[model samples]
Target: MADDKKKKDDEVKKEESEGKKDADETTAASSKKKDDEPKKPDVPPVIAAGLRLERILTVSSPSGGSAPKAAAAGSPHSSDSATHNAAALTANVEAVLHSNPGKIVRRWLGTSSGTSSRATLADLSKGAEALLSHDGPCATGRELVMLLAPPTEGGGEAMDVDAKAGGEEKKDDDEKPKFLSTAAREYEAWLISLAVRLLWRDGRHGDAHSLAGKGVSILSAHMDDAARVTARAGAAGSLGKAGGASGLYPLLSRMHRYQSLAAEGLAGEQGESARAAMRADTAAAHRMACLRRDVDTQATLLNLMLRDLLNANQVEQAQKLLSNSTFPDSASNNQLCRYLYNSGRIQALRLEYTSAFSNLSQCLRKAPTNTGLGFRIAVQRLLVVVQLLMGEIPERNVFFTEGMVAELSPYLKITQAVRRGDLPFFKTTVAQCASRLREDGTYTLISRLAHSVVKAGLRRLNVSYSRISLDDVAHRLGLSCATSAEFVVAKAVRDGVIDATIDHAGGYVRSHDLVDVYATTEPAEAFHRRIAYCLTTHNDAVRGMRYPPDAYKRQLEASRGLKGKKDDDKTDEEKAQEFEEEMDEDY
Candidate 1:
């Protein structure tokens, strides 16, 4: 019992020692923690106060404070990183615009592959068509024009098209910058054409005219440059492959339609004063379409203006359109033919029979047969009357062309009466066909044939008789008297149709001896021209040929087989003498 009590006392003492050791360890850990802990640094009072003021301003701005509001608006959304990236992108885009704007623009449209060029024209056409039907042209087309147009100072942002009239004033020469490339000119041309068409179709003729008539009138400047553009097709894109501005055709067709509507209002037989007033209005409309520098529009303007002039019998105005400079050969076949036809009619009205014959005949040959049969028929009808008026009998086949027999039958009677040299028959035929010809629009033209019929009768008389008195000729021609017959013969003689002299005192007309035309140098000129052309073609053929392969081969074989005999013979005096004698003999 005494030993157990001593052990417990030792255990209690050991427990007390353990507790004291634990307390000492905890105090050391607390000291280490205090040493390792971080302490706050002292702050400057002014900076701290200013920072607190900035926070207060950001959270709730003081009155009259603009800085915080601006900061709030200018700051990016919750995603500040996106806003930061966008700003960088905007800077990059601005850099590109300042450096290579065209390059960047082309990059967006993509490059042309083999098939892409074909699709390029198609895409452009589709986009143009779509724009025409949309309400967005004033929106998008205005933007496109600003993009394609010369860059201006201040880099004005494209505004709504309601301000387009204001933009028109912005087209200044000095401010114009070269922003478009040659490839882009096509886009410019297409835009201009589309704009004109839209303005035209919208019935804003005055605006269309004004827009097209601007000093930088799109058509007047670009059209004449077509030959140059097409000539440089290889340097430009594949524009030539797209037919070198086929967009002009449709645009021109619309212009033609516009002019046709103008002409139709004047087609009716209004009173003289009303007709004149309407014609003046039509002229003004066409004149507006005439831009100062555009050849195609100028020509078309001249053409439409001349049509009214010719119809009004204003020969002076017709002279301008009839001038050689009015029509360009670059125009379509139909336009040229119509121009030639109208000019011919003007010439005929002016009594220039030879010039009329030349122009009308050329027009008849070029008039598209299948597309506009009425126009072709009109041309043919004019040709018949003009041929008759020229005192020349048209051949039977002239009236019997393929697909034209029906249209020519009425004129066939006129042709026959002219050929037969029967004045009464001609008069009777004209009387019978007067209503039909009037509806065909050739009644006035055919009525003018009365003088020609008398001329034809006189021509036959000169062939049949050596001398005919004016009295007898008047009786045969169904004229009222010999005095009129004498005057008529005098006119025909001066006109060079009949080789005859009118003897007024003797009251007889004398025929000069007719020479055979085949004996003249006129045929020789044509033959010589043909011969020269043939010789030129032959020379070109000969110049293009290479050394004859078979002949060279034969010569080579002969040299190889001659065992040096050819060389020896060439050097030998006797062989050379023989060769010279043989050549001289042949010569």
Candidate 2:
């Protein structure tokens, strides 16, 4: 019985071991199956694409532990609302895309602030993929929307490729889709501009330049086509708004500016070819602007060309541009301010202090007070140097203005030295701030103030002493020798800077009594300038006022129509009643 029991127990143990091994194999197989299958990402492709386009590519990944996913998954209510909003956006995009070219332009232009809403942006982003097609104006519009997004982790090269339809490379330029409508072509131009900006931002200067050049060609072709159409139609089509060519002028100017910037960025590598391309583009754009009478665009390109010339140290070319081109009084205040600022810098470089001062002051006053802190600071810095060059001390409050103390500190030190007529201190300050001043493009102008400092010291000497020896004057003004001091004093006397006479034989300058108040034309000239500025301001204000077309003509016609009624058609009582009625109408 014992032997039979042992044999049965062995069989039972073997069976149990086999069963456990089978279970282990089953668990391993299940885990391997799970590993082999691909996992679905918590974030959707639509969301990812929008994020990539909207932000820097590198930062597109969610950082906060899948917070966005959790938020979507956590509430059914949120998901429903998101879906409804996306549906609405998809419908809106479809409606806009299907509309006529004129209506599309009007709707797009009317909603300038529409893109600022987060909810609307999110909804549109959700439907972006669905709305984008392989070809046509809608595709161009979609590309524009994508290009509007800033940047990310991926490089410009990849983003540039990805920006194309369906992320595929174009086989040939000739295969590009044709936009039939003017508004479509306008959106295409905008897309090109935005792409250029994106690539430029990504540090792909070569690509940006090439793309901008292509854009210019395309826009030129479009404009030519419109002109040809208008010509074919003759006088009747001239009143048809030239198929909205007015809108293209600004974009054309923008493209040219971008092209110049890109070429400038590649100047070191591409050499003169890049420079030639920039000049050609700018010149072409300028001619077009003038031809179109696009005052705004003309003003913009003028500033851009001036900036380029100034940066290249071609002051003469900049001056010529300023002289040759008239900045239209019809330009917006912002463009006007930029033109004035550039003009002031050029004039200061050309040793035209009075005109420079006038331009700079007008820029400062006309500049928008609510924004552009950096612009204000730059204008102020140049203005201070120009004032010092003109032998005038800048106000104390200028240096200490809020938000500009740090940037203006160097200028402040230079101003102090000039104000106190301390030539040694002035030279020291200039030396210390030389790099910054050069960076600011004012080193040359500031260097000219050494003479101003000397004149200021001479004026002080005339006020304090009846006579001062040239040797003493040289020592006091920190000049290298007495001869330079004598020459400076003689020039000051000749220029009527100080009431003094140079005695060459005695080697000294004699001080004369100060002239009486209001005895010269200085006050009258100053008053005249103030009055002229006021008149100019008033004139500009009047010119800038917007009125409906033929408004004056319509008013005059209505008044004349009222006056043309016959007076002999009524008796005395009726005439009196008619007179009373006319008086009431006038009132």
Candidate 3:
């Protein structure tokens, strides 16, 4: 009992000691926390006050109200860093614009406020003119004029939807910009006049005339002496005459001025009134020829004369002038070839086939390769027709050399289809060639002949070829025969097949032997046999006809060896070539 009581006392003492240690540790930790805490700086009251004032100013409005209402008005959503950044950005832009007035004005003009959401060309031109005036003399005026000019494509019309919708669009009553009227608008009328001259130089006569006329009208209305003289000189120059129209001498030159006007009238337009204008101009040019030693004026007179000759089809005289003139060699060659080709076409139209062929052939030989192919093909086709008309077969095989077979195949296929009397085939063939050859009429007879041959073949087979239309074939192929006949024929004739022939009567007929051969088992094989026989026989005959007895015997032996070979090893290409050689001999 005594020992138990002692142990309980010791345990109570130990508990008291642990509680004291824990209390001491808590005090030390509190002291360390206080020591590690950051110290606050003692800020000056005035500086603090100034910072508060700035914050208050930013928060407050002109009415000296609280920031809450302004902040809510500025952004109904809860204010964040993004809103503050946006406000900063806005302030920066305002500051920039305030600093640079010119930049600000330029930006304003470039934006919708100056040009409007839908600015017409006239508005743009007006604004551009104002900008150019403010900016002082530069190329800006010319550049602006060019920019305000309508686009060349789409009939030179505005494409902007907004511009098109506005009532400010170009009006029917609006006269073309003439030089005289425009010149009255500003001292820069000379600039406009110069622009007109440059436009004429660039072959924009319509624009030049319009602008020049505007300038003239403007200058005349204002009638300042210097302006009048300048405008009159500009007008004369724009009209392609020597300038200076001032005093008694100038008045005496009134007859020359009238002549110049007459010449202008002739080049203007062509109709009943135009004819009268041309007559007046002709009289004036003749009179000017008598008066002025002006080389340019005299040259213009000659040009007018040449133009008249050309219009009358008196090409020989015009051509003589061209030949004698010191024109560039390339230009001369091109002109000569064009004239010859055109003359040939005229002869063709008149059914002078021989003359047409002669002219066209010469044209082809002279024309550059790039330009020549089309003309060459055209002449060749015409020659083919001429040959046909004269009862002479065209040597088409000459055009179908190994190098040109791929290109010529299409044309030949078209011819074959036409000969076959396959109208559907011919139509499809024509559509394909339409892109390559301009004139379908030129090949009409050849196409017809092709159709006839196909028809004859069908007739001989007792199978109406017409019934097997291209449409039916297209359906079977699961595609359109929008393909060229050449493509179709190439596929058809690839294995030594001649679809038809032009008979002596100019009608197409199927080669009966070919049809019979195709009707046999494995037609390709049978055709090969026929080709071999024909080639061997042809070669043998040629040797017999041309060679001495000893050479003929040797040739015969070789020919026999070729015929005896029944090997199926030879390719289709080899067989086709062999057959072609045989056909060449037969012809």
Candidate 4:
């Protein structure tokens, strides 16, 4: 029995020793494997940017097909899908980074919109967040690029985008790529712009402005590189249409605008100093736009400046801006609508009621009917007020426009008071809706309508009585005194508000007999005016009609072809005629 127990203990100890030996062998093998596997060096930011850009270009390329759709957020496979995407992107980057930056920029700009699809753009942005998250030492675009470009290689004059691979074999001559300084600078500028935009979107306005300024400097460097290339190539004239850096101008202009806007946002809406800074930034952006001949950006900045001035209650400055620099008639409809609206407001303030009404009417007509309900409502409200100030009653349906009845309610009350000649009621309505009027930015303009209210009262009195005492006029029209009432009636008569005469000596006003409209040319003249307006509108619409993309060009090409064919046939006939005449002469 003792020998059996000893044998069992010996067997258990041998089994435990065998298990320990196997575990020791496996651990040694794993440690050896880990040591043998090379560690991945950290990706430099510029190279990483190039990689992301390449991936984006590939996914957005027409021949590349659509990128793999990402799994919905929070799905179990979402993490897996993201991992797979990152791996795929790294593979693409590794495969393509050996090429020069010129090839990469060419590929990038070759895309129709200069950006990838939403999925790929998002992926690239996520990668950018990782690469650009660092704040110090390598902050600017040039610094990032310099890291990838070794100074030993002629101060990065011919910086290739590829990171070093220690053991890679030499590539064939055809496979090897040449470096382009211009392309490298362009790539740097693009990365900076992207970073700045992202920073701004993330509410880091100060950082965004700093990065954008860096981008501007990079763009300047790119322009210098382009000029050098042009001069070396013996290209003539200033950097015009054929300038190598022309493609980067748009990017540069956008950077300027973005930088200015970011700075403005950082300046906040508090002090005069902030406003001055904002204005200075805007002026700088406009000058850049003008230099680049970027008309769209110019128009946009003009409208922005005008809005800023108006919001600051600097009406004179707004007018000077409009007068000093004409708003481009070739601007977009939305921009033109805004310009017209601003011009109308200025005109109203100047008491040029006729011009104000004309501008406001045009603005209302030009404003989009289906969209921009707020814009349409604003223009419509101002239009009604201007019409009243012009001594003309607005049409009843103007107040009840669809999508605007609720907004125009206050204007409707003002209009009712004006048309009814109720001076006291008009005063009450203005007081009650003072806050709303101020909010709509029409308080000052509405104050001028009191004169219109007086004129309305005179018209009512003209219809009601052949003559009335000045004291009665003061009481009925809510005037402060009989002298004020007499002065108002005299001005109204001189302005043709009512066919009445103010008898200052008699201290009363007398109305002329009502004329029959059908017996006069006024009705015919009004009808003719309406017809002319309708015809002009129709003609304008016909001229302004737009064809689908390329449709007009196709039509023009087709017409030219037919005309050429006709000319060819005519030339042949003329040749035959001349040949017959020569034959007759020979005979």
Candidate 5:
């Protein structure tokens, strides 16, 4: 029975071993099948397109702790793939940027109330500095026009010529450098502007101005580039030879208006103390040449500077600014008129009546007809007084200009009262217009015309009577006393308005013999003056006229147009003869 038990145990052991071996083989075959069937693509099968944007967006914690490990474990081989991608992306981004590339910029970047935001802004600024460096393949100054140039015009056909010359090799050589240049140029401008805004916000205005100053060349280039483009393309039709001046106005206006409204609101919110702070800030900004230059806000800067100079009574400095190249050439009609008007006002203040009259007249001529009523009224009001001061009466038609009736009513009364030598009427008119004059801030200036009224009254008195009592003169001219009347007579005598002598002891005025009005040797002095003025005007017109750049192009077009009409009458030789001189200039 023992021998039989042993035999059965051995057989059972062998059967068990066999069963285990079979099970191992079956497991191996199934593993092979799974392996052969493609093991569920462990690493998202290396993408065909190398630059996958999703890689950038994917956030992975550097710490790879329990949770990440757990996640990795769940995905089998996914952790390896993720690690590979992360490494590759880091390498690529590092290679694209500088050795220490710094942080990437975003439009809505905000400070974290920490050092991080500032560091990022610093990084962006550094990048801009790198771009602006001459060593880089960056576009500089007005060369930006190449990027924006019309397809039919500059550089657009360069690609084809390049392709025909060197096929793909030269293209490959040229394209990379070109792309780098463009990327660097764009990044420089954007980063610089970003840095400026950031610095401005952080109360680093000095730094901001310094940085902006460096980019003034680039900003001004944009203006010149735009003007050239517009001129070449005839882009802004009917805007005239003002070039890009009118085009710039709306943009500048909107920017300034928004800033003003914002500042005003801030002052309103913060009250009186804020106003002084705001004014200081404004003054500082206006004085920063770079900030003003970069944004093309120098026109406003110039105006502010002029105001400051005038306030300081630095007339020479203000006049120097007016004559300087730094002064913007008034290209827009509105700007031209305003500039003239301001010049006129300043001259009037300085008692340069002739220059003031000329400037005001130019302003009126350039100003929009039936519009700019306020500007016209202001000019006319000052002009009427200036004319009277110069011993001239403005024509009646001047008061009847379209859209100027109501506005000039007070001025007309003043003019009419002066013309008729009615002293009391003049005084009454001035008193009645006192509120309006004060409102216009011309009360002091208009009051100066009161002396002119006295002069006119004395001249009339001289015409009516060869001699008159000083007391009677005081009564007629509405003077307070006989001493005032003698003073007025002496001034009139000195001015040669009315030939007169003051009898201070007898308290009477005596008039001298009147001379002939037209006693000049040549054509009357007035006629000679008019002739000289005409000659000067002609010379100025000649100096001011400029031929357009596309004059030759227009001539060519004209020639073509006339070819249809003149073809039968003239030979090809005649047309060629006329255009030959122009063609060389064009070339």
Candidate 6:
């Protein structure tokens, strides 16, 4: 019985082992089937095509890292292909070139064996049209037009041309060759006009003018009778707006008779020529009217007009324009102030010191800090001169001691260095005073005068110093030393009443006689007389001790005798010293 039971167990174990082996085999087969299964065929052709076109059309680069896969797909034309067909076409084309170079030559040059090469405008135009029609966003069309366009004199060669040929082309070559059909040239003109119009809208007036002018010239050259008139008128209008009056006027006059004829022709209901002329005239007139009406739109125009008036010495006209024009109040102030300041300058030039002072002072009051500097200096200049003329020591001294001289000194040096023509220092001083009074400040009056003095001094001497001595300057002017030397020097520098210098010996170096220096430097007999008259009138104010009338007469005679004498024959320094001694004795 035990033997029989063991046999049964062995049989059961063997059966169990066989069942396990079968299950293992089945599991292995299933795993192998999954491993061998193909990946789902790539994205559908239509879907892939959509993604590629989207990438090409959009401004940004393609995302999702799918571009490579899409590119790998057969040409877009092949519904089932996994790569781009366009790339394949390009590759095929390249391979063909490698294989048969002569084929490309034959295709491009037009003959089977090549050698016939005449590029016409029609060909270029057709190419441009085709490029523009393309759905791609590439710059093919615009770039082609730019490439065909003629270059400016200094402009580099066009990319389409051979570099060597580009350098040899004449500047006038930028124009389309006469061989080009008029219609083709017209189309080019239209393109240029469109570009200029776009630029104008973008506020690039300079570029717009350049391009518009070129287009207009071309249209005028090649456009038909009717088209030419229209083009001329359009170009005139654009030039007027973009380049202002200077550029527009010439074109307008050239088209004036054409415009009249057009108007007359239109009244008679003439043909296209007359009608086009009429249209051109109408456009030009519209542009002119628009320019006139919109004059206020450009701040530059108003500013330039005001500046021109000032430059022409037309102060009244400038003032009138400033007062009548409707400019932004804030902007108008700077120009208005400038006008007023200039008017004051004119008054001072006329020696109307009081009127000059008023105008400048008013301007100074209204001007901003940055703009106020000029007006303030003007006021100071006038005050200094007026004080000197009136011999008001206290007032003069106030200007000198107040640090006004320091500010003006450097400017004076520069003016002197440049050797600008003689300007009436007194007038400038009066102008400065008017500006300062208008502005209103404690130091305004003095500061302006001081700065003016410095400017005038610089113009005369071209050297500035930290301090100047009034006493030494007075002595050089043949006047007794004043209590405030700084004040005298400031006055002298401001008014051009005297030329003063700082000596190496720590004293002020000044001309001994105003008339003598004026005569020597200016060589104007009239100026010399004026200096003498001014000096004689201010003799008492200058604080020089008066000698007896006879003694003065003798000195004057002696000076006249010394005139024209050879310098080598007479000791000028000794004579000058003797003259000083005589004056000291009289004092």
Top TM-score model: 2
Q: Candidate 3, overall lDDT?
A: 0.42
Candidate 3, residues 483-581, lDDT tens digits: the string is: 433244334434334453323243222333335645667778657757965785587467556423355765676788853353356778687665544
Global lDDT of model 5? 0.54
* lDDT for 135 (candidate 3): 23
Higher-ranked by lDDT: 3 or 4? 4
Model 2 stretches with alpha carbons more than 4 Å out = 1-133, 137-183, 225-242, 502-507, 546-556, 559-587
Q: Rate the local accuracy (lDDT) of all candidates.
A: 0.55, 0.67, 0.42, 0.65, 0.54, 0.41
* Model 4: per-residue Cα lDDT over 1-587, one tens digit each: 99999999999999999999999999999999999999988864444545555355444433342221221121122345445433333232222222232334534644523342121323333333333312211134545433332134363523342434432346664443322111233454665666666667778787777677667766766556555545555442333323445545545655766775677667545334555666886788678656644455577778778877887789899889988986654456777798888889888887888678877887888888877999888888888888888778888898888888898998889898998888999999999999999999999989988888888888899999999999999999998999999888888888877898878889998899998879988799779867977886798687677545556765786877874665466776586665544432221
Model 1: CA > 4 A from native: 1-135, 138-253, 262-296, 436-445, 466-475, 481-587
- What lDDT tens digits, residue by residue, belong to model 5 across residues 229-338? 44454333311223322222223322332233333333244434433444554456445433323223445544545654554457776677667625454234565576
At residue 555, candidate 5 shows an lDDT of: 81
Candidate with the larger TM-score of 2 and 6: 2
User: Which pairs clash inside model 1?
Assistant: 220-294
**Backbone clash count for every predicted candidate, in the order shown:** 1, 8, 34, 0, 0, 37
Off by over 4 Å in 4: 1-124, 127-271, 502-507, 516-587
| Model 3 stretches astray by more than 4 angstroms | 1-331, 370-384, 397-587
Candidate 6: deviation at residue 308, Å?
A: 1.7
Assess every candidate by TM-score. Answer: 0.45, 0.66, 0.24, 0.57, 0.48, 0.22
Query: lDDT winner among the candidates?
Result: 2
- Per-model root-mean-square deviation over C-alphas: 28.2, 17.4, 31.8, 17.0, 25.1, 34.0
Model 6: weakest 10-residue lDDT segment is: 108-117
